[model samples]
Target chain A: MSNGQETSQETFAALEALKEHYSLPSLTFSVPRQVQGLVLPVVIAVVWEALAQTGILPANWLPAPSVVVATLLELLRGGELLGHIGVTLARVVSGFLIGALAATLLGGVTGSSPLVRRVLDPTLQALRSIPSMAWVPLFLLWLGIHESSKIALIAVGVFFPVYLNLLSGILTVDRKLLEVGQVFRLDRVQQVRRVILPAALPSYLVGLRSGLGLGWMFVVAAEIMGASRGLGFLMIDGQMTGRASVIIASIVLFALFGKLTDLVLERAAKGLLGQRGIEF
Target chain B: MGLAGAHRAALDIRGLCKDFAVHGGRVTALQDINLTVRQGDFISIIGSSGCGKSTLLRIIAGLETDYQGDAEFEGERINGPGLERGVVFQEHRLFPWLTVRENVAFGLGGGRENSRGESVREHIDLVGLTGFEQAYPHQLSGGMAQRAAIARALVNRPQVLLLDEPFGALDALTKIQMQEEVLRIWRAEGATMVLVTHDIDEAVFLGDRVVIMSNRPGTIKRIIPVDLPRPRDRGSYEFTHLRSAIYAEFFRQEDKPFAYAI
Candidate 1:
């Protein structure tokens, strides 16, 4: 019995030590605050350089990271890349904002009232089934190959996803929560603003993230169809001249911008939804 | 004025009927349910599941629109939900995005005439959530969340508070604590409250009058007046006697072998 007690004491001590060690969480090393912003591009540059130097492929087809940087700088100096970036950014932002705003308002109306949902559901369903690219020819016919056509293309791409998600989110809010609002004697407007809007936010943010990406993709496709400026135009222009560097540069810029936008949205979402009660 | 006000009942619910046209058939949830709730009275409705206790509370709160009912408050007919009636559901149902303070304020309305920021803060403190005003509902424990829900319901200073198994989701210890908290709040607020619960002990402990209900097209089986004092001892003879009586009634209904009768 004495030996058994001693062995159990030793086992208990070991268990305690194990628990302490497991409990003592180590501090994680965060990306350096200043250098954090530059890490992704820096890693890309290192990989690009390594691939180019290895000579696993032809040089003409695969430019070095330095070569791409120099070409980007040259394009900036020539006032071409900056202008294209500006045009593309402006078109995407405006079109996405318009589509998102309209979809949100319509979604709210449809979500709250079954009558409105029934009226709008079939038509919206049919429209959503048609691809955004399918609208390009018709949009071009109506608006011509101008900024309007590009905006229309991006807006069409963004509309369905944002509306559907927002509507569903609003519809699925806990009925019990709404009853709380009623008990308080909250007016109709107050119910929507205070309860429905906040309840639908996480889903709305998701819709925004997806809608923005779709809008960007549609804009590039529209630009490729025929535009004098923007990233897609730069790629088309490069393809016409057999200049692979410009096409590759444009692709890189698209990726960089998309990543930046997503990062900003993710940061905002974390700030808004990270609180204890809020569900993502 | 207090005694006179207590004599004058806050709510008089008569001939309350509610039915649903479910896929199976017409289901009668409540039938000819009549009840009177005095000002500052604590009443508990005890019944089996599907006994329509919740439906009755919802009708009083005006959350159920399709009910045929004559529910009046202060001698006035209640057509819809007003600021005079408040409800706490089984689930806390606190809004996810808002902090405890904001969730409480949501019922206060956005009008200029309505009390604003500081008054909202006062109500939060009253519910014993002084430090947790900024905490979200999900961050709170089940009991705390229910407390927050009660706080939210009481923020409007409604005359009638309807609780539909508010502490049903809590653990035993937490439920006991919450029941004490609710009783304290109800006394402090001097609000007429109708609580629906399955626990016989709970119904006996907190209620001034326990209304036992029969199942399916539910009607009041009996209304047992609890003559016990405030903060009544759970282990006392009266408490056990009342609890056993309610339990006996519940089982009596359950054990009826009607189909086997010749």
Candidate 2:
């Protein structure tokens, strides 16, 4: 009878341990997470509007949020705002895709092979040290002041972050995991496809995000140099014509679109990594 | 001989010596080790830390080949890792990106998509992890993750399975449970297993024979055969007798003063 009781206790303890292991604390929020994030921004916007209404600041230098909104509406009604946004979005997307593809191929090669890393890393590092504006003049001369030069400038900006992050990711893959690949008798291609690539994916996604950010920054610089249309052109045109509200509207659009694209990339990355339960 | 044919021994190791190159000087890790594991036998190798028992197992698994030795499996020269011998590490080492199902399927390699899916499911069921097929490694308890690791190792249907302290990380209760599970699996699969561990009770409980090891240029000190019947009781007199006998070997080593070579 005593032995039976002890066995039952032991089984109960084991079951309790297992239950504890499986139970991860769920996070519950009264207010939605996105709404909580917006509280501070909303407060700042209200304060700024109040200050503008009191007439302490001049209208030409720092336009009110309302004034910027009106200017944006006027541009929208004229049907030119959408065209500028579309053209700017196209340049950024095209440049980002090209840069990411080339970086992934090169990063994979250098990350996996020591010989390739030794041969190419130094030259790439030197190229990365050159400023983004420095490439503008060279690219303009080489590809001419058109869509190609602008796209090339954006690609160079996108290249370094993606390449560096991916290379570091591959290099830092756990040695024990590599040993698992070896013990399983995985050949070179099999090792890359199954072990190294999957291990480096989280870092690769991170690189893509930062690379897209740099692509946006470079597009602005590209359009400022020479372009007939785009948000950057709108900003330049506003500056020349001394329209503070228009300049502010263009800046606001840049912020909105940049954040929108990042959220989209983040959503896609979450879908890819949802099963693994990795945090963004 | 092929795996299907009869063999003299599952693993044959003789005059095995290994060295490590540390800061330009060579440090001997294992020296003149000799052991022959019979087919369907469970051999437990016990040693203190840095005893090089793990190095010996790695050599047999073909993960470490830079050594002077004759390590053969079923009369074939072991040059590199092959599918015939599977290894389970201390850490589960499940790819975090892969689900339980996909991680097990990885053992069958990336080809023959349709045929191997059945085998992957079979191994997952064998480990009693059928319902949690889509779960990631972090979602599992330590014991469950290790079970998945064992399933992945056995998915290839290897004749020999090498375990490097496979249950060393589990809690006491879970460790006992996993030991019983392993013994049951050994009987079911009839695969020759070599388990390297530091636990005396564990070595006595699971092994058909226990090989004692000594450190500082590691070598096999003794090989004690266990004649206990199946489901051996831990509290039995015979069990304690064998456990103390192995403990005596380590106690004897402690009597001598520490010797340093510098």
Candidate 3:
């Protein structure tokens, strides 16, 4: 709750399980590997800067990269941007926690039992087909235009993907592997812990990442509609005031935060799976 | 000592039948299988594909439960999987998520015999995979992975080691090397081994008695004793003769194609 580190690590662990299942290569910890990913963004910045300097594009529409950087720095010092980022991050993390935990539990139950899967799966699948965005208005009405509503909306949006992925993960585990568990004479509890959990990790992680991405999207929608103290509100305010630089700065901040969280997740996954002799 | 008593069978099966409900009616996977395995003896079960050799092994390991008639371990009626019997499949079946050492250690974790008996390192070294403890299943060659699986099974100190075609996936050279390794481990441990394979030479090379199985609705056709000495040469006439004897079961029916031609 205090920081994004633990939640991101959990997601990474799921991803690690997934990568291990697929036998995917993990990111090597190297300076070059780190530096390589940034090349494209740098190139885009150069192009943007060149176009701005030549005045080929209107300044208001496409502000100078330097101007955007200065605005970003100004916002950083004032502590205003951090406040918004903090608020948005808190919402995503909490919402993600609720969605992921519930989905994982439910998924485990349903995945292990054919009767439960038959009973619950169809209704959930029907609900999943209706995009999470459609639930925003209903959520707003049900919980009101407050933090609860917004967080609830994000949570609702996040639940299905993780639930579905986790379910599939459990369902699709190799029977042969389970047979191996049987030969070892693992008790039911040990079987779940040693065999089922590891085998289902990949799908669970895919669900988490999917849910996380959806949660972020819904948070933006929830904030834009009602909230006053989040990045989405900041963007909406920028639009209203015709402050393109502010808008662009907020966008860049969003992108940077998203990338940062994802990178942390990727690293966490590598560590968790790497320990198991899975590279990823 | 005064009076020597008769030794008990490591495994005893009588009228064991396994039938699977298929598309419509039930299909017999195994029929009227009667067998007895002596303590500390290596028995190889060789059969053509779909002969239910693997199914029979699974039944003995207590991985399969729906079979009829008697299947007992050391005179106790087998019901479920037990630590006293360790089974290794054709595939290494090492958990990809576990390292070579961790996979080997897994057998020690759960079971009635969870005495935490042997050192994991000792088993790994015993398999000659000392250096690759950190390696994953995907990183290992087929032979190495099989060794890891063997180590995992042996670590439990099971009274009977059930191997379902343990070397069926290897290249010819690696298979020979692994055959010898199995013999070394078999001698060292002196546990009862029942290895199921389609390879006739493998059966003759490793088994004290080669059990030949007939095709679908499988039943034991014959049991040929391989009276060869240690480290039996593949090129030797006696070894080849014993191997051919095991292979002969496949061609017992004259209308059937030659077993080797396929």
Candidate maximizing DockQ: 2
In model 1, pairs of residues that clash are none
lDDT of 2 at A218: 94
Candidate 2 residue B92 C-alpha distance from true site, Å: 0.6
Q: What lDDT tens digits, residue by residue, belong to model 2 across residues B181-261?
A: 899888878899999999999999999999999998899999999999979999999999999999989878767634531
State the fnat of model 2: 0.71
Instruction: Record all residue pairs in model 2 with backbone atoms less than 3 Å apart, i.e. clashing.
Output: none
DockQ of 3: 0.37
**Candidate 2, DockQ to 2 decimals?**
0.46
Local accuracy of candidate 1 as per-residue lDDT tens digits, A77-111? 99878899999998888889889988988898998
Candidate 1 positional error at B141, Å: 2.4
lDDT of 3 at B194: 97
lDDT of 3 at B73: 91
Alpha-carbon runs more than 4 Å astray in model 2: A1-33, B1-7, B112-116, B256-262
Could you give candidate 1's per-residue lDDT for residues B36-152 as a string of tens digits? 988888999989889998888888888777878787889987777888888888988888877788777777776533434776777777678889987887678777888888888
Candidate 1: lDDT of A41? Answer: 84
Q: Global lDDT of each model?
A: 0.84, 0.90, 0.84
TM-score to true structure, per model: 0.85, 0.91, 0.85
In candidate 1, position B135 carries an lDDT of 87
Candidate 3 lDDT, B1-262, residue by residue in tens: 1122125688999999999999999999999999999888899998888999999998999888888999999889888899899888998888888878788888777442332345688888889998898787877778899999999998878989999999888879999999999999988887889999999888888999988888777989888888889888989999877766655667764356775558
